[model samples]
Target chain A: MSQTVELKVDLGERSYPIYIGENLIGDTGAYLNKHGFKTGSPILIVTDETIAPYYLDTVVNSLRSAGYTVVTHIVPAGEQTKSLSMLEAIVTTALTGNLDRNSAVIALGGGVIGDLAGFVAATYMRGIRFIQIPTTILAHDSSVGGKVAVNHKLAKNIIGAFHQPDYVLYDVTTLRTLSPREVRSGLAEMVKHGLIWDEAFVDWLEESASKLLNLDLDALKYGIHQGCRIKSVVVAEDERENDLRAILNLGHTIGHALEAVAGYGELLHGEAIAIGMVGASLLAQKLGYSSDIYTRTKALLQKFELPVSLPKHYDVDAIMEAMSHDKKFKEGKMVFVIPTAIGKVEINRNVPAEWVRETVEQLKGEA
Target chain B: MSQTVELKVDLGERSYPIYIGENLIGDTGAYLNKHGFKTGSPILIVTDETIAPYYLDTVVNSLRSAGYTVVTHIVPAGEQTKSLSMLEAIVTTALTGNLDRNSAVIALGGGVIGDLAGFVAATYMRGIRFIQIPTTILAHDSSVGGKVAVNHKLAKNIIGAFHQPDYVLYDVTTLRTLSPREVRSGLAEMVKHGLIWDEAFVDWLEESASKLLNLDLDALKYGIHQGCRIKSVVVAEDERENDLRAILNLGHTIGHALEAVAGYGELLHGEAIAIGMVGASLLAQKLGYSSDIYTRTKALLQKFELPVSLPKHYDVDAIMEAMSHDKKFKEGKMVFVIPTAIGKVEINRNVPAEWVRETVEQLKGEA
Candidate 1:
């Protein structure tokens, strides 16, 4: 708490701050009060089963001590929890809890919980305030953008809204409990922030990869702070993802397809995006869009120990079909955020389908 | 089309027009294209079985003729149609039909259809464009306000969003197909538009009640246009119901409770609202907030042949319990939109529970 790093996502009245700190969750009540969460208003804390055993009691006690009525809805942990059925179940819990318009919902987990709870806040009573407590590094990307959603069976994040949070409270101490795979998974998105926007940050992440992996609090804090800052800048400018924000989906094109093709269970989201980023770099190089983009992007992702190739078991045609179903897919064109440099990308709207198909094959390490 | 009357809901960039006329559904394609719905974009038409048999083909043919791809999802016609299950099912259709971010959804029915489809559009891809092809007279009120939602089992419209439509196409010809009860149910809202904001409109409605009941096209169009114009003005002033727009809920607090108590089958929305309005006026008189509000309101509702009294079978405690679950309920306070005059209301944040209970009993015509 003594060395908190804060960034603001400015969207006029909907603007909010993101606090990256240590042990902030213990002071959740104070933060909620300082951020204008109405006194005595009810709150719903939505977390995953995995996180509940660790932090739910602390959050509930903090909120209760603040004289606010608190309710908890714990969901099963995983990507599958981000579904319409879960949304309905949580909404029912909200109703039974008597959450009113003045009430707030706190998302107390990773990307999946943040998105699900944010959407509940977004649609409950036509919109209520919500706060994000991102426990995973991957949420450093999802939490800042206000892009809350659930995945349909056919597509990932196909049903969602751009409902900004009141603010985001990131307590890095929660990261200590994550499995090695989860830590690597979150690092992929942290790396993505640099890949899409800041060359120097990407260079720093590469240098500090081992320190971050070993959970050096200082390095982890600095890395998460930098990642969040980049994401907030992009979100503040393009909250709705109209034009400029599309750049944030740099690797999502093939990344989402890979996830869908693998049934969303084989790879974590950040891992999928890491592969997608590698694939995009390959395509960029093939099209002469950049110099050494494939080698450089792959190297950074590899440093983070993230996957850089699609599993050989994935079918190319299935991946293509999945890409076609993506929310970003428009008018029968393969829309890719192609990197022109280490930290610069261009929206390529008409990438040849065959090029993408070949890139899929290449990603299988066959080429 | 020549007699079409147009008015705009001034919401800046989200602003849209309301067209009141005859046979607008047959020209929905032209309207969609004219309103910037892309020429080649796919569209999903969401309507109930009742309206589907009547005008779905016309909408489908109209869009197809204009070189726009079209898909349709039809649900059973009733208040029950607005639910999370149905929302998910329609989202599935949108996905399977390949409706993209560029595509649009057309809601072709009454308030139920408008709200359901608008929510689908609002959430599909975080929101795509949608048009309101309102086929029932009751929609004159619901279609104008950007309040789109589905009901949870415990409350009416508890889960929803304020996603405005691209435009609303109100074709009076469709009103001819409505049964007598349905016509009266719609007129209840039309009369309410007057009760909440315009004294002269109330007077005019009183004089033209017979014509509106007969489905006289000219009277219907004029009534709808005025109703929409008044609603649009309120919505523009308070798009999110934070302040002035709350006046629009004059009877909805009690009305929504009735709908929930009655299982959404015993009363059409407008009918429930009509009884609720009478009760509101009665409470206002008792509170000394207004003069002659009760008699005049009951007279106007009776002129439209809408129910002014709650049925005798309803449990008072049950209705009271249901009201507590309303999105509008707060801090154990009974929030009611109380009439101050024949054409104006104010948000009453704290009405006595005992008085509300008495008023509910009085509304049963037992006093």
Candidate 2:
């Protein structure tokens, strides 16, 4: 049986909806029209080489069947694709395709495609419209938040923007193709949603772990809906990360640093974040913010086969240096999202650098 | 004796003041601090080769003297400096200088530097703060509207964003170094301000032409202030160019096409716009929208020693083709800002393309 779930991100005029369903890719044109995208203006579909073979044609054909003038830009699949060079390439394609101010760019892959295409939409002639079509589990989080960016050679997401999409079309049917490693990596963010603000979600996600891993459609739909609902609420309150939005960066501070130090190819984004969340819990325990947060977080991640410890070879100094380059780093202070309980976090702006150094060292010895 | 005039652009929180005065470059640090820019976070001063010899050091030394950390990025002075390659280079300088979210970028040259550096500030970490230090007469128009962009190989301002600056510091003293051609070129936009929204200013500009040409401080200050005030009002109502802001593009439609067809190097931006305004008036008269606009506009531009007609050598077909690629081009119709009267214009989306081709042809024979 096919089913669909919908949630809205309430941002006044910038607000948009997130649609989670089975086989939604084939109906993208209808969704776009429902959201007021004009068929007379052109649409650019930005996807990756890996995903193009499966879903690109379907999306293009659907849009074309519905009378949209469509252009496709296929980029190589990887984190490296999120570069300024790639952005310029996409912009060239957009220009060649004659995409005007009324045009919209559709991101038809996972987080990388979403970020890259969203950014292209954000800056092309001072921003047009953007749509996100998530083909990976990780995108459930990236697609909804409107935090689009491309990596800088010196740091991650160093050049980017807060461009909200018209809506996100999350077809979980596409997630069936993800490799086992990709699946595990994607679940890290799902667990993050639970850890940040919803204790009940964490408990439910734990109970439904096997069902989610098995690709049970009902479980997947419910889990994604909850994750997006939580995210949309947080984003609605802090669209620009002015204040409450920092909570969403709970594990990203350490996760982004780890990704930067590891050259972006060593670990999947979610795997890095899984380890970062555990490290945060350990730091929480060290600070007496929580007594058993470290143990509980480690166990939950272990069940999902997510990495909860850093490798011994990665340098602590490199990790620290990368964190300082982060957008969250302020005035030489080490800012961190510290877990206080199973479903609560606090942004600590003055976390001692030496303490973080000790926590990075401790992560390697754990498990 | 030196004089100063301050004007505010009212976009609520995005609102900032424009300061028109003599020797403001030497006081750049005080103004930045007054605007609430932090002294602790590093600042990137982006300038160009032509202006670097005169004002860069004064600006840098003052900032340093005020206990500020400053990094300088200087590029070749030309329209070409507003390219993605140049933007990437400046981003590298910003990264190497360790500019974080709290940091601000100071555009210390003319329109080219302001557009390029403002774009860097717009996207670097998804937009930080930006300050415009306009060094040319033309920047009075470009610096106020928050329309920052870089050109593409195929078109002008094909990539851009509406990121307003924290404030504008216009030091008329810098205008003294401009060559006669440069001075006249800069005044085209000053004339545009009068033609679009203030007829009294046009009569005043015609009367004070020699004073402005001679770099008389009082005349220059008043002219720049009026230009900025009119632009700020238009932008405040439609910050994103949705409706009323199209008035700012009065001459830009043909002006951009002329610049694009001329390969960007042959004609100064304001000179191209001066000729475009003449073409616009010619088109208005052809459309029966106005009668004396053509003669009056051509005479005023001639009085300022600005170009009032397109060069005969340039291909008319090429200009028409370039117009189709412009940001202002929509659908198959010719969208132009047509002057219905000396102090007003209307956005006509259904202007015949053949009529525009005819107007472009007519511009070559005028005067």
**In terms of TM-score, which candidate is strongest?**
2
lDDT per model, in order? Answer: 0.87, 0.88
Q: How far is candidate 1 from the true structure (C-alpha RMSD, Å)?
A: 2.7
Off by over 4 Å in 1: A263-265, A289-291, A309-333, A357-367, B260-266, B289-291, B310-333, B364-367
Steric clashes per prediction: 0, 0
TM-score result, candidate 2: 0.95
Clashing pairs in 1: none
Error of 1 at B105 (Å): 0.8
Q: Model 2 chain B: which ten-residue window has the lowest total lDDT?
A: B324-333
Best by DockQ: 1
Q: Residue B67 lDDT in model 2?
A: 79
Cα RMSD of all models vs. native, in order, equals 2.7, 2.3
What are the per-residue Cα lDDT tens digits for candidate 2 across B128-156?
99999988888888898898888877666
